[model samples]
Target: MNIFKYINEAWESLLSNKMRTILTMLGIIIGVASVISMLALGEGASDSITNSIESMGTNTIYVFRDSSVTNSKTLTLSDT
Candidate 1:
């Protein structure tokens, strides 16, 4: 029931099943690596988008004309 007894039993079990231990360790390593890679990729993509938006001047404005409304006024350079 002591911690040392539990540790000894676990060690013995692992040693007795070498293949299972190796496979379990390999799975854990691969899972951790995959998670890290995905997080890094997501962060890189987010930073890229933020940098692109920031590089565009703050005064920049985008206007989209609605084709569904025939009565909408068209934007021209003189309107600025």
Candidate 2:
């Protein structure tokens, strides 16, 4: 009923089944470790992609022309 009594009972229960206690702790440790590792991996991948995009200069632009347009002419140097 009191704090110390509750703590004592909880400790006793844990100690009563040694194998179960160990297995439960192992599962919790493994779950936490896996979650942390996955987060680190995702952060690393995000940073890599960000660095790649930044390295390619911000002023880069892409142009697309439809070849199927009958009268469309390709721009030449003098057309600029």
Candidate 3:
């Protein structure tokens, strides 16, 4: 209810438990960093997929004759 009391209590607690506060902050920082890295990786994967789709050959019917055919279905930029 009181802003001054809240501030005073927070400051006192922080000052008294310096190492604990810093450790908690570090955990939060690591979580945020991992979340950012995952998002960036996801975006990169999506962009690559988009580029691949855009460069697909037109009127080329993909024949999935065999699943073991590695070079059969994949169309690279060179094929575009």
lDDT of each: 0.95, 0.94, 0.89
Once fitted onto the true fold, the runs of candidate 1 whose alpha carbons sit more than 4 angstroms away are: 62-76
lDDT of 1 at 41: 100
lDDT for each residue of candidate 1 in 1-80, tens digit (9 for 90 to 100):
89999999999999999999999999999999999999999999999999999998799987788889978787788997
Q: Which ten residues in a row have the lowest lDDT in candidate 1?
A: 61-70
Tell me each candidate's TM-score: 0.77, 0.76, 0.71
User: Which model is ahead, 1 or 3, in terms of lDDT?
Assistant: 1
Top-lDDT structure, candidate number:
1
**Per-residue alpha-carbon lDDT of candidate 3 for residues 1-80, written as tens digits (9 for 90 to 100):** 79999999999999999999999999999999999999999999999999988788676766456777667666567986
> Candidate 2's residue-wise lDDT over 1-80, tens digit each?
79999999999999999999999999999999999999999999999999999998889865689878899877776986
Question: After superposing candidate 2, which stretches have Cα over 4 Å from the reference?
Answer: 61-80
Model 3, position 56: C-alpha lDDT score: 84
Best-to-worst order by TM-score is 1, 2, 3
